[model samples]
Every structure is written in structure tokens, then in C-alpha cells.
Target chain A: MTTRRGTEERIPLLLGVLASLAIALVAIPLVGLLVRVPWSNLGSLLTSDVVLDALRLSLISSIAAAALSTVLGVPLAWLLARRRFRGRRVVRAAVTLPMVLPPVVGGAALLFALGRRGVVGEPLDAITGIVLPFSLAGVIVANTFVAMPFLVLTVEGALTNSDRGVEAAAASLGASPLRVFWKVTLPAIAPSLRAGMVLAWARALGEFGATVTFAGNLQGRTQTLPLAVFVSLENDRNAALAMSLVMVAVSFAVLLGLRDRWWNNR
Target chain B: MCTAQRIVRRTGAVGVVLGVLSALVGCGTDSDSDTLIVFAASSLVDAFAEIGAAFEEQNAGADVMITTGGSSALRAQIIDGAPAAVFASANASTMDAVVEAGDTAAQPEVFARNRLEVVAPAGNAGGVSGLSDLARSDLFVGLCAAGVPCGDLSRDVLGEAGVTPSVDTDEPDARALLSKIVDGELDVGLVYATDAASAVDDVVAFATGVDMTTPYLIAPLDGAADPELAAAFVDFVTGPVGRAVLSDKGFAAP
Candidate 1:
């Protein structure tokens, strides 16, 4: 036993070198970004009119997207978790497809399906004067399309692993299914639900390709932080760096704060 | 799952996603000295394609990989250490950035020039006729962001015409703006005449009578792996063969 522990403690030199390389591959760019950040002008850059407008739009759209995800995702999660249906695997795959699909492709899909001249958009616009693209609603839709899958998948996994006997007990004790859900099932998966919402929110806040493609980028209308960072990289690298740092900070805070508490389904 | 196991699993999942994505994009390739990389602006896509083919034909055992994107974006990439032998930019400003960053071997020479045109979707959904129609607030007018040469020219032409454009979206490049117009998502947009020519079936281009033009510049990068090959590529772009191809693609001699 002692000999086994000794050998286990000594990682091979080659492995150590390889691991360091792997970390360096990821850390070098981040370190470089930090080293080159326009620190003296960061505050002013972040508070500039362009940056401020993008920040405001990003927050409003991402928060609205998160709320929409929770409202819509929780139900979809429950449906997948509790219901037994044919082609369930296909449905599940379709719902979580965004998790793996390139955000740009997802954006293109959304554009083809919902753009002003899109299949449904044309008819809808003709009927009710509701144009989805280039509007705030379009931004929210783009965010929600890319963000909701995180929430749905997280909540669904939790629901699948949850103690179902308790929900059955509530239902059997004269409570209707809706009452049992609101009073029992929801409270039970609250931790995972919160985790999912935060993940989705962070994902939405950082959304770029999908938002720019589907919603289109306008200064005060559709430009989010990621879009701002992208466009700024051309003319104003410092502003891009500043906006990137903000996203990195926010995402880091969200992941670090959530890591210990809820990520393990704790 | 335990935290350690979850972390490892998440990492594995991310690795798989990245692997698939990278594979979809193309294989990770080592830099090959024989392969000359040329970064060109979006408006030069068609012209550069023919030029790349002709350059490859002239120089045996040489592979020319031409990548097209917004000149500003390509300039940013080059400045950020992209390993390209040559850069062909849509505007002098973007090429100036590369020169200012000490990426260029010499001053970029203007090889070609392009003018802006007002374009609408194939159906002309918003009934846009001329540059003046871009000011109609009811129509969804799209324009390239000022970061790109086309956008700068568009904005200047509009200002010169005394038209207050009611722009709905500012696409990052002429290509994006053109694509949105062709997709019928945007009613009208300003793009390079070359781009408008490339998609005649999907969009209708109108002469704006603005007389504004952006000059295209090409330069070999400093410290290129194959300096001779890079210089040759730049010369080929500025030479008679390049001019013939550029003219066929609707570019005027600078």
C-alpha cells in the first residue's frame, strides 16, 4: 500500500510538461490580453456612449432572455422529465441542439425562420405589422434561442434525477397535479433551476454571433457587449479590450460563485 | 456527481465540442513555407480568386490560400500576428494600420479602386429606387459599419447628398450587409459595386451619382517566411495580369 501511494504521488515528468503546455495554451492569450489592456483609459472606455449603450442593451436583452428561459425552459424540462412520449430522444436532441450548434448557424436558422421576410415573419408582418428582426424583440429572441438550451438541459437533468416519490405523494394526498407541481416539484428542483438560469443568463450576456446574425447590430437597438467588442476591435482595440474584460469578469464571477454551491447538483 | 468528476466530465464535453468544431472548420495545419497566404478584403473576393488561381498557375509548386473578410477585420488579424504573406485591403486606411503596426515591408500601393452602389433585395421589397430612398424611415435600411471602407464611403456620400439615413442595422462588413439585403431581411444597403455585381440575381444595384470611391491597396508583410514569394504575389496583384482580372471583376485601375 505504501509503495502504491509513493508511485501514484510521482507524476511522470513528460505528463507534467504536457499538462503545463495545455494550461499555457489557454492562459497565454488571457495573460496577453491582461498585459495589453488599456488600464489608464478603461474606466472612460467602459463608460463611453458606445460602450454604455451596448452595455445597457446587453443587460436588458440578457435579463429578459433569462426570464424568458426560466418561464419557458422549466415547463419544457418538466415535459421531457415527466412525460413518456414517442420520439422523445429526437425531441430532446432537437431542444438541446443549440448547445452544440455553432451560434452563427443557430442565428442563421433563426434568420431564415423568423426574419422580416422569413417564412413565418412575412405572414406575421403582413397580418399584424410585427417585424421580429431589427427590433428589441428580435434581440431577445436571439438570446433566448441560444440561452434557453442551457436552462432546459440543466433543469431536465435535475428533474430526471429528482426524488419522484415525493411528487407522487403530494398528488396522491388529494392535491391536483398542478398544485403538486407548484407546491412540491418546483421547490425540489429549485437549486438546479437557479443554476440553470444563471448559466443561461451568462450565455445570453456573452451571445454574439447569434445576436448579430438574427437581430442585426444597431447601436442602441441590437448591439450587445460582444458585438460592440467585435466592431470595436477594428478601429478601437482598447475599447474592445475593455468590453472583453467586462464580459470575462462577469462570466468569471458567475462561474466561480456558482461552482461550489449548485454545479454539483448540491 | 462529485465536483471533481463533474469538472472532468465538463472538460471532456467541451473538448469534444471543440474537436468537432475544429474538425468542421478544417484540420489544424502547421505553417508550410510553400503555401503563400493572402488576406484580402471582402470586396476583392472574386477578383482575388481569379488572381490567386493565375498566381498559382504561374508559380509551379506554390499554393496560394486566399482568405477574404472585412479589410478592417483582416487588418486587425494581421496586426494581431496572423501569418499572412500578403494583404489586399479595400481601403488605404486599413492598410495604413498594418503599415503603422510595422507589419508591412513597404508602403502599400493602390492596385484597384471600387465605388459604392445602393442595393436592394431582388424583390425591392421596400420599393427603394435611389440613394434618396435610403432616408425613408419606414424602410429597413442597412449599411456597413463605419469600420469598413464601404460604410465610410456610404456615410460620406449620404452626408454629401444631404440625406439623413434612417439606418436600422450597421453590419460589420460589406459582405454581411450584402447578404442581409439578398436575404431580404434588409430593404436596402450600400455595398461595393463589385459585391453588387457578384449577386445580380439576388439584388439590384443602383448608381448613387455620389462619385465617391475607395482605393484598394496590397502589400507584402515584413518578415514573411518566403519573402520572394510574398513580393512576387504583391507584384502579380499590381501587374498587368492582375489589372486584367480586376477590370473583369469591375474594378478600375487605381
Candidate 2:
């Protein structure tokens, strides 16, 4: 990957201009949000009852989604990466479909599959009297449906590129299959695992369309921070801005936490 | 041609197309000739849609584009300069927001009236024989989120009926709530009489025993692209033809 001398100086003006415009596209709206933020009472607004409830729910659902995604996505990702099975490619495509689908569509798909009158939802309800929609459980389900793809994709890439020699050696040294996975393979992909978890958690925290569509927007029950901001945008602009500030700050912190893994040059 | 020249030509073509697209977006149905953009409350969807087509037929070469949402949200957009040629609000205060902001060409006139009605699936009824079902915790109840005209009105109707609902989802708009009701998602829900009537095939409406007296308002916007045409459209909505269409769709005369 050696570069010739003065190659950076050859950068074209068109690309430089477009690159700056791209940066502005991402940065301007954020700066506008900062400008309109109600600075005087932001601390108080952030600590208000509604805000606190939303934050608590967001943390609970997002963390739960991330954890569930890891437990489920890792195995799926591994099978996709390592197994030579029929329909493996189909499974991988299905797993990643959520990443590209509009989250509202994903939520509607969830409703069709898991709603009260849904395919599985009908039998599940008839048997257990449990309805997934319009519940806190629904919020977690929606988040996991949309966020799991990130974890699965990242972990699968890591697994595919990971060294298998160590696990084979550990197996030859009398380690059981489970011990090889835990001791040799798990630690090897730990970096990617951590990165994947954080990415999935951040996606879950910011999830809006699916959660709102599936869980419904009830303050203190199903209203995550994003939904709270949306409901408030009509009547309370200051509150929406305050909540958005919290989201932006948290997202920045998550990105900073992953800097060591992704921003190796820094 | 050189590869660099080809890239430049492609970029230029893209730039021109983007420029044209943005110009069209900037106009946003604000032109004086063909398009008439109307922002109406969600409950007025079926009624206004009919009125729009009739108006279009009379005013040949004029297209009517209607955007429907919660009245409060619609007013917020109008006040923020969405360039809507006409606005039809479900409540007076929602229309007042635009009037107070000086975005209306004139005072909004009361054109129709609607009230809340409870509804459940037409068949396979969910024990929703009366308003009492809205209070049942076992059944899923849906309503428009607070701050929208329908949400505010729904709360009023519920309060007058003295039934405290176990609301499951506060939909962003009344139409979204209505669609879900028709989908058999909700056991019972409160929606505009007009909405319930439009969806009579799917839902069975019940009287909440509360009279709904809210008056619907419509007006021409201040910066309408075609001021004369906008005023004409407003007149058409408040006129005899509009009245007939509104009543046919289950709206009461204001």
C-alpha cells in the first residue's frame, strides 16, 4: 500500500469541493439543532419526568436489543460464514434485509408476523394470551428486528477473516469443542464483537419508525427518546430540541468509544 | 474522449438534473397555472378528495393536490411557510394558529361539523357494544396522539362520556388510527364520525351519547401562487357543492 510522493497534492478541486459539501450536509443540520436548543433550561428539561421516562425506556430497550442480537446474531453469522450448507446465501440475504428496508416497513412486517392477529401472533395469543404489539416487549422486538443486522454483518465478517489455526491447535491440545469456542475463538473476535455490539446498541437507541409503528407512542410506556421528540415537536419545540441534544451527545460518545477500533490512525 | 472528460460530462449532466429537481421542489405546487395545493385535516380526507375532483372538473386544466395530516401539524407546517394554497382545519383553534400568524388570506369560515364515534370490527365483534369497551384493559384501544385536533377532541369526548380508556397506541394522526381500526388491530377506538362513516364497511360505529359540536374551518392562504384561484377554491369548499359532498360523506352542516 505504498503511495508515491506528492500524491495527496494531486487531489482534484471537484472532489475537494464535493467532499466539503458532503461534510456540510452532515454538519449543518446538527449545528442548526444546537442553535435552536433552549440553553437556559436544558438541564432542567433533560431531567424532567417525561424525559427521564423516555431515557430509561430507551436504555432498557436498546441494551436488551443489543444483548439479544449478539446472542442470536453471532450463531447465525457463524453459520453463514463457516458452514457450507444449502440456502446459506438465502439466509444471509434474509438476515441483512432489515439493514436496507425502511424501518417502518420492517415494523409492519413484524406486525404481520408477530402482531395480535398475525401469523404466529394469533396462535401465540390464543395459547398464552400474550400480545406483542403495543407493549414494551414490542419496542424491544422492533429494535432487535432493525438492529440485529449490524451485529450479524460485523461478526460474520470478523469470523470469516479470523484465524482458525489457533482453534484447531487448542482442539488438538485436548480442548473440547465448547472450550475451543470460548477460549480460542471468542477472544480472537472480541474486538469485532465489541464494535458490533456498540453499533447495534446505537442503532437501537435511535430507532423510531419501527418502535413507533409496532409499540405505539404512549408516554412512560412505549415512547422512546425519538418518539418523545416527535410528539413534542408539534406542541413543545424546546423539549424536542433538548431531547435531540441528548441523542446527539450520546451518539458522539458511542462513536468516540469505538475510535480505537475504527480510527486506528487516530 | 479522455476518461477525465467523460467524468466531467457526467457530473455536468447530473448537476443540471439536480438543479431542475430542486427548482421543482422549491415551487412545490405553488404555480399559478395548473396545481392547487390543499392542506386539510385528516378527517376531511374522504370529503375533500371528492370536493377536489369536482372542483378540478369545473376549473379545467387545474389540478388539485391535497395533503392530509393532523390539523395541528398541518397548521404548524403552514405557519412555517409550506406554501399551501388552502387549509381546512378540523378545529377553529388550529385554523386560528395560521390566522394569528398572518398566513391566511382571510378569516377561516366554518364549513362543516363532525363528532367522535366509537367503532369496532364489523363482524367478529370484540364485545365493543358501547363506550365502556374503551375502558376495558384487556382490549387494545387506540387514539390519535395529543396535540392533534382529533386527539384533543377525542379526549374531550372521552371526558364527557366519563370513560377512561386504556389507550394502547397514540397514533400520529387520526387517519393512521382509522386505518388500524379497519385492519382489526384495535378492539375499539374513537374516530371522527366522518371517518367511521367512510369506513362503514369495515367498522361498526356506536353512539357515545355525546354531541360533537366542533366546527370545521377552511380558508385561502396568504402566499398562494394563484391568489384568485385560491380564493375560488376556498369558495368552492364553502359553497353548495362542497356542502353536498361533505354531507354525503357523513359531515353535518356548520
TM-score for chain B of each model, two decimals: 0.86, 0.85
Candidate 2 segments whose C-alpha is farther than 4 A from its true place: A1-5, A9-11, A263-266, B1-32
lDDT accuracy of residue B158 in candidate 2: 87
lDDT of every model, 2 decimals: 0.85, 0.83
State the lDDT of candidate 2 residue by residue for B1-254, as single tens digits.
Answer: 01111111111123334323433664334343356667888787777878888987798656666777677777877787775788889998888889999999977899999888888877835878877788989788998888877888889888988989999889887777887788777888888888888888989999988886689999999978778888999999889999999999988989
DockQ of each: 0.65, 0.59
Best-performing candidate as measured by DockQ: 1
In candidate 1, list every pair of residues with a backbone clash.
none
Q: List the residue pairs that clash in candidate 2.
A: none
| Candidate 1 Cα misplacement greater than 4 A, ranges | A1-25, B1-33
Worst-scoring 10-residue span by lDDT in model 2 chain B? B1-10
**Cα lDDT tens digits for candidate 2, A1-266:** 36777867587999999999999999999999999999999999999998999999999999999999999998888888878999998889998999999998998888888887789988999999888888899999999999999999988888888889998899999999888877887788888898899999999999998888778888888999999998888677899999999999999998987887932311
